[model samples]
Target: MATIQSQHKWRFFRSGGFDQVALDSAADLQHLSELDPKLWTVLNCPTTGLEFDCRTLALLDLDGDGQIRVPEILAAVRWSCERVLDAEIMFKAPGLPLSAIDDQDAEGANLKAAALRVLEITGKTEADPLQVTDLADMTLLFSPHHFNGDGVVMAELTSDTELAQLITEIIQTQGGQLDRSGGLGIHGDSLNAFYQQAAAVVDWHAAADPADPLFCPLGDKTVEAVAAFEAVKAKVDDFFVRCQLAAFDNRAAEALNPAVAVYDVLSNKAISSSDKDVAALPLAAIAAGQSLPLGEGINPAWASAMSQFKLLVVDPLVGSKSKSKAGHLTADQWQQICDQLEPWRSWQAAKPDTTLHQLELERLQAIVAGDGKERLEALIAQDLAASTFADNVDAVERLVRYQRDLVTLLRNFVSLSDFYQRKHKAIFQIGTLYLDQRSCELVLKVSDMARHATMAPFSGCYLVYCTCERQGETPLQIVAALTAGDVDELMVPGRNGVFYDSQGRDWRAMVTKVVAQPVSIGQAFWSPYKRVAAFIETQLQKFAASRDKDIEAKTTTGVTAAATPASTPAATAAVAGFDIAKFAGIFAALGLAVGAIGTALAAMIAGLFSLVWWQIPLVMAAVLLLISGPSMLMAFLTLRRRNLGPLLDANGWAVNTRAKINVPFGAALTGLARLPAGAKRSVADPFAEKKRPWGSLLILLLVAVAAAVFWWFKLN
Candidate 1:
């Protein structure tokens, strides 16, 4: 019997027979909580829009399994409220330094330390006050950097100079030893060998006697003469040796003939020139029964005569042969001897040329100086130092960002307690009910009921039942918003009623049990609208069916009566005979009927076209309202009168309070199933036939064309 007073600025309405209040503002909710702590039930409920930080939610969870239950929520609310005053002081002046948090408690000590670190890494002095801007700046530190890794403040060498230094150091350290061919640097031994070879050629030239034409030829003409004689002598010796070997070994003949051919050419030239005596020695020796010493025992004078040749040719050949079998050369040794010949010959030709000698000396001197080595070492050192400094900077930044995030999280969780304490409804509710012969479970929670609720007669508020048939037996369950009347009717423990759900599924529901409690009944002034809708629906359906049956009967009777005359043989014959006058009269009547219909349609169309475009839309809108106004009005009125009394009474409850499940509150009671976040699932029936939309598209195209043609004509 308690009615809400208008002066209180809070409105109260009867819902499910209980005095219910709608708290619109934060202050209104706070006042309601002060009136009764039980009203704080909404604080423990999981809400959709609050968007609590995941870490804060986890901290409140206590068990750490990511679910915040009622007990956890209540504990969080109490803890936060107790510490709220301390938090408020800090929040009121966000610019306060870490020293502002002066509590002796462990949590306070941790916060103070965290605040100090945040200020330090953000490049703020300890004396500098923290601001909202500082917190925002700290969040930016978590942004992604060039490096690919997790955590705030990654190693970012953004400075071009620093990055270039890093690249140089890497190249000097790992790629420092590479040669021109991209192979590893030459060994110390190879460097020494190169120097020794160059020195040897120079020394040989320096030691040469200028007076001895054989050892050192000074003029171009003299050099040519000496080279020709040496070449002819060498060829003759090689040929004579091959001929001697051919006498003992048949395979030697193959090499002997080629050498003989070269020797004959040289011998003919020698015989006709002044060098015949020198060239004929090896040939005459071979003809005499003596086999020339091809190994170490060769005449010493002959060897000495070839001493100038030794460094240029003989020494390399001898050295290679020494590495092989006695009097025989291995393939590798032969190849080495041949490979040394070209470079040796080149050196010999350039021995007297001072220009090349000076250039070679300068290059050798530069290599031994070691200036490049020192520069490379300095670069490596710089690179190492830069890397260490960068790593240290990143570490400090990460610590600072971590501290900032923690402070922000604490601020959010602490403030949320007041927010929830002022709230008045649960995110969801659960109940047990019976439908037909089956027990049903209900999870009632909705986001917005005013927008989603149905406006169709009893659809606004009714006991909805859903039945699932299994194994030839159909089981029914009730999924409805209960009213006081429904509870009262069911309180007897065996009340039965028929119910229909949104899907039009029928259920014969019966009350199996009822729990006694303080119940609310919904009784509003608009309750009569539901009754009116039900009456209208029933009467309309019955009238339409009766009228359709009557029309069908009349049509059938007329057809039967007309066929009776045709059925008789005499009448059929008369009807079949051609009657010009009668046919003409029938045609005239048909033409007149069609003409009248055409004329009336043309007049209506012309009247519509005569109206201005703006007025035409208004007229059409008015006509539409005339057709659908009654149904829409009925639905709207019924929706406004939606009550929970009949639903609750049907389930047997002694209602004492008005617990109004209004548009908004009713939504939170019944939750509809929705797709989970990021969920994707596709189902396809294998037996389904593929469909072509072309036929429907073609029909739509034709309709559009016809409309366009009509509009064009109308405009003209």
Candidate 2:
């Protein structure tokens, strides 16, 4: 997402996530907007009333009741103890639930402080939820390769000069005999050519001489040859026709195979095509995920489980000292961690399955080495060997079962791990994105160029994604582009991109260019969190229900499953010592905080009315159109690009469920309005960038008073 940062810049700097409710902490006249510096000064703001839950960030009224305040201008004046450094992190991953990181800074400018920052910047806003479905989970997302393999060479290879010198010395001492035997095997193009020649010799077979000159060359009959050619042509036509008919017969045979029934089961209408979403694309599961077929990496059970939990991320968890706006974790540390996990996978692959005997089935797993890999390699080294023709022509009865079993096991391990790694890469962002729920499928599907990989500061590409961790009706795709500065371009979907869905389908996306700008890490991880959270919530609910049933069964009939998560408690605390009065006071204080600002706003309104004339509808239709016509047009264009009609259709489970996710301004604003409140539960504040000016707003208020005074004097 290096290129997706533009929207973040445009959002924080220009649009400022503006909304009406959070703008006027000190209540302003309705229908008016502005960035009031005074609003920044007083703690009391009626419009951006503080909510206890803190997910809702209040909107800052920067321009005295007309325009939103610029974040930079606010930061320049008074420090609002909100922004994390100067960057916006809270807005990126508000629900990350990172408590340890938050305690680092009291002023809340540290990386963890960003959650509060996003709110302080936005102030607060009241909103009617948009007429959209499943938007609460609107967050950024993407999949990148994160499950890294260990280094091949633990120690660096010797340099050419060192190798050459050693080789020369060896040759001088042993007259090159050592070099011929051990220094280097027959290799390079020369070795390849030798093998080719040997293979050619082994495969060479002389065809019987069809000409038969030994018996009949003296005949030399041209007229007879022409007649023979005509006969051959007729025979060739008949053969061609027979071959076509055979092709048709073969097709029929394949269709009738049991394999065809298996394919039908795989594509059964009962499974993916459910009544909940009949209009969804028949290939929705394909759209959800794609990797090697089953029997490659994991068992069918594991594959199905994984399909439910794949992800696609673009950046790495380890932050390099590269030119990135978001300060990421140390790359070397993350690499070390990546190295540590290698043995776990290797151990799983090298499970001693084949070694155990059937007699030990109750006590042990088999770990037998089938056909040794070394044996296969030895055969492959022979000149006569081609994978296509490695046949035991003498019918020596090769042990095919052992070799196949190991190969099959290795393949299954590789495919599942690779797919899981891809999924982890897509959604498991490093900075934030705490485990909203621990046990659910997180599938990541991304499409890139065929068999292509790109190197980053590390050996391979790493992708980090952040999304708005909100609830939604459907799954979404989030991406983030990293850069050193504020970006302004919008990033859209591109070709061979990855997407993860709710039902465990992770598929690569087929798209063209996705124009995007840099997005902060916080903005990238929100969607996955939302999905995981939803799944976890559901799981918890289901678990609770099951527990109730189990308890009932145990009490009534004394029957239960052998497995159990239920456990007895050691002790219980008495509730008699609880202080109700103190808790009530705390609640009262919270209520006062919300209402205090409204009073101040009422006073300000009274004062303003003493100076103003009347509601002349001076903001006439023409003037209103002039002020917002272009903006309205832009909004309209954005709606069309978002394609909510198609989205709504999909949500409705009507026809054509291939809906698009276009992050619209309204949707963003809604996310923004809820930002401050959302930040309270997450790791850090995401929106508090630079604070608005207190003096600027006070100055304006004083100036307005002076103007009203002057008007009264002139009338007198």
Candidate 3:
């Protein structure tokens, strides 16, 4: 890959500890494709979650894969530069001028024509340079009723009432697609699907002609007859099966019929004919070779259903034919009714499954038989004819955006000079987080804290992940880099702050997590001493609490003893008495402890006095180094190695450069608080504590002890 080269001469600048090619002119961007991909700061970046214009990013992301890669950027740059006559005009201006468009090439000419058409439609024919906002006003270019080459025809596209109502019915039944004009309409696929379902429904209804005895069974009344048949079919079949079983074995009849105990249970409570247990009994008494008595001997629970069945089904097939008695249906007659309705059952089962069935059959037939489908097809074709115009308008939009945003993107992607020079916030920097008495500008939007934290530790910079929220909006997480301030107050997880986005929208932010690293060398220098002080304070608090508990227990014991009736003066005196021997022993131990500490102090003071003043300073310096040296050195190494790559990579960018944020650069990213210039200061305070002489007396005593030690050393 190194052997491969471009003829273009590239100029480079040093930043982030690496060389980045300069994209300062149109020629540089025109030749960007020939440049080495290895030198680009970012190979690709997500089209979302950035401070840059997302609309422009979407235009650059040709594949629509949510990432804008080097090839896509190169293609966009090449296309935009070619369409312009003087590519240098892109950097100098914010909009694309009509005269600047190169009309020599066919593509460029088409784009210019489209731009003119857009201007004509918008009444901006005199607009020298077409702005991005002009193209964004879609209402001016296409109305809800106009065809904009999206292949969708809205109901208002036709003035014919029948056609419009047909389109509305198609949309209501089929759930139409939304068109570019913001109206719900149908494209070819949806329109074809709707009519096809309509045709199927018509064919299904036609197959059930009332004149066909095979399907309708009872001319003009088949549906009602079939419904009645279904209602009583199961009970009638059960009754016949029980009769067949009784003929097979006589004893089965007595067992299959309702037992006397069932009536005994019903006798204990008020019962209705429609009661569930009563309906649950056999439809009629089971008997061998018995015709089902439809009228008088029938189970009261099933009487209503049997009447409808007799009128609709049994009467039509058997009573009308005079083949059976009026009151009963034999087993053979029931079989004949089931056999005659089978064709209709099969026909009904084949009905189409679609929401189009909601339309009346006649309406469906009229729609299928009319020219609505052909008209819709023609309308879609007409809409599709404007596709080229629509695409050209988009090209105009892209041209305008590229003229405005191409150079900025090149700076952020190819070089990152904007970030390094501190002239602009990088695209990945979402907003500034004001926290811990400091304003951190290098804040990035975070989607998932757990996922970000996994790779963020490698950045070697102190980061705080906060959940920011506003009322009536969703909560989002952001990670802010704390580079300049002391970390003493920043490591608290529940700390609150305010974040201002690039648009100046304020959100309440609360720190939910802290990824600790060296914020600054000064903070590291005091960390060890602070830890020691904290440990001492914690121990003192524990000791005080224990002592208080012990004293309280003793006081309670004394009060109890005083209230006791059996407590004598002798007992009280024994408890209160202190042994003189024990007192004397404790005093001796205290004296020995004091003597040992004083001896150690005297030795240190005499040794210091014996040394020369210069040597004493050196000794003190060495002691300080022993305490704070390792911490500062470690902090320095970490601060130097802080790279912005991992932070961006965790957010879905393929950052190709190290993008180091060394100590000085890091400090610029985070701004510590300071008073305004010329601010006044005063020493007097009404709430200040009273003046004290103990500090001065302690200093005087220390000087006197040093003088006495020097005198004694001279005498020796």
Candidate 4:
């Protein structure tokens, strides 16, 4: 095969201990496409941030598994090269119009049609070349607000009066021309300014008339009344204190003059009554003689004195006479006073009722009434025009994004082509590693490795190593897999054997490092069963060893006792005298155990026999499936997903392809033990014994007899 050569002199670069070529031109990309598919730098890669035409990649991923293989990439490049005017044209221009595309090819025709449709949607002339601006415009024109179910430019105001008022407010609040194009559109910066200005206008109007319309007369009256009641309460308390003192002392009332007496007591008649009571009481008793009592309802003289004083003083001072009369405040009287003062208490307590809404409505009405309406209308018109232009600009911006994405795709593919052309011998540019301990595999391309060399490698895969210890006499081996990264600094050969992954996560690993090949599913499938068998064999050997030791101990004791000649006779007799009952009991117990197991087996067989003939086979099949179905299914699935991606990803390579290692391919990747060429081994073993055919013949005869009996029973 003729090796492909690059038309342009490729610039060389070093990354991750490998030589790399810079893909700077379309010719470099074309030369790469001509090289062997294996020589391509990457097979499968995540398209997340890398620019590549999604449609092209989709075409390249033949299996639709979101990965593009070398063959797929090569095929796509070849197809495009054959059809397009120049594959490089994609990278040269920001975009091309539908007319620029060749209509001869199906792909070009479809793309052209799509571009034309985009132009139409954006309200651009059909002849106009499709650009990033056109795509952006289309997106904006179809946005929620502009293309809502309702007709374009829906009325912001429902009523003519409201519209006129809004216009007037806008004119007065924002006197300058509505420069929507200059950042005054709905989503523009000027809208914020507009709001601030509107708020200022409202504040000015409110300041001019500070009286709140929602303010209630009752609220003010309630406050005033509460203050008045507080003032009166102090005076009443002083009067009460003086009266109480006077009642206790006869000379206490003499201190109060006629002017002070009227203020203290509501009536002059109360004073006369008090004087009569004082005269009736003995002067010595009134002077608080030790035998005289002053308690109410207890002493007649004291009671008569208190009763007259209260009727003439306390009743007229604090007691309520009628609903209209207020001598002093009582609980009911106080409540009545509050109620009269504030009737809107309940309304006030429910929820706050601010007058801002009413104020705003008034401001709007005022703005609409004057000559400001015409100016406001003009401003609205200007704003609408600016909004239309802004929407177009947004569309253009979005279209530019699409262009950038396409440019990125072109750049990546072109670069890949250059790399391939320069490195023809790198057939396995993407390498695969298998880790038996981790049961993980990785397939890494050159680019993925370079990226991984960075401080923060991608998280998809990691390299890890650990020490594996065998439970028995086998020496420990260091095993590694695509499972750990540099972040796992604490990981060591022994200890917890923990390692960190590329994602900076820790994991306990049994492997030291990833290998070039891993154990296949066939080998893995029987590993557990083999381990169980080995364990059982070891246990049985240990049990046999223990039983032999016990027997040896007993023999040694018998020999030791026999060495004493005196006990020899008794020991021999004891050995010779076999206990028939004990023997019979031992046999009986053994028979019972055998019978129990046989009975259970018989019962199970009988149950199977009771089923219909066809059902018996099905039941047996179901039993077999129940035993091995999960194991087989798991093995099959594991085998299918056993790809080289994870292993490569761990090593910091971005595998863009499935790179599946099926059974046959897996076998090739990992070799099994085999005899060397021209090697010979002895067929005979020194311990081998001759076998007789009688036992086998007898077993076959018994099986035949059993089959005959079963057939006879079924016929009967």
- Per-residue CA lDDT of model 2 for 1-716, tens digit only, reads 01222221111111112111222111211111233332221111221111111111121333344222334223312222222132222212222222322244543323333333322323422221111111122111100111001111100122334333423332232232211112322212332332333333222211222244432221343223323323333322332343344455655433322344555655666544233333221211111112212123322323332232111100221223341113221224323323533333333344333211222332111111222223222322432232111121100011111111211211111111211222222111111111111111221121222211121111111122323222443333332222212122222323233434433344443333232321232233243445467899999999999999998977654333224333433211221136889999999998898789866765554555454465424434556566555545543443333321221121111111111223332232111212444565654667767667997999999889766665665565
Candidate 1 overall Cα lDDT vs. reference? 0.42
Q: For residue 420, what is the lDDT in candidate 1? A: 22
Residue 32 displacement in candidate 2 (angstroms) = 56
Segments in model 3 whose C-alpha atoms lie over 4 Å from true places: 1-9, 137-139, 143-147, 155-169, 212-217, 242-282, 285-303, 315-317, 320-328, 355-376, 557-589, 681-683
Which prediction has the highest lDDT against the true structure?
Answer: 3
Please write out the lDDT profile of model 3 over residues 7-87, one tens digit for every residue.
Answer: 888999898888988788878877888888888899888888888888999889888899988888888888888888888
Between candidates 1 and 4, name the one with more favorable lDDT.
4
Per residue, candidate 4 scores C-alpha lDDT tens digits across 525-614 of 455566578899999999999999999998998788667665567767886577999999999999999999977865666667668889
- Candidate 2 worst ten-residue window by lDDT: 146-155
**Cα-based TM-score, every candidate:** 0.27, 0.17, 0.89, 0.29
Against the true structure, whose TM-score is highest? 3
lDDT of each: 0.42, 0.28, 0.87, 0.44
Judged by TM-score relative to the true structure, which candidate is superior, 1 or 3? Answer: 3
The alpha-carbon deviation from the true structure for residue 275 of candidate 1, after best TM-score superposition, in angstroms, is 77
Clashes found in each candidate (C-alpha, N, C closer than 3 A): 45, 149, 0, 35
Pick the winner on lDDT between candidates 1 and 3.
3
How well is each residue in 1-716 modelled by candidate 1, as lDDT tens digits? 12323334555444333444444343342233233333222222232322233433445557764444445544543443332234333224235545544547755455556566557757898888665455544334322232212211111323444433433333333233332122232223333343444455456565645465444433334344345435535643464565557666766555544355665666676343235444343322222223334345443334434444434343434545553324333334433434534333444666643222434545434533434334433433443343432343333332223223323322222122221232322212123334433332222322333322332113345443322233343554434443323232334445664444333444555543333321222333223455567789889999999999999998887688676756678866774568889999999999999999977866666677678869988988887666556656654565455644333323321222223345444444433345789998778878888889998999999778656655865788
The TM-score obtained by model 1 is 0.27
Q: Order the candidates by lDDT, highest first — what do you get?
A: 3, 4, 1, 2
After superposition, the stretches of candidate 2 with alpha carbons farther than 4 Å from their true spots are 1-612, 616-625, 641-716
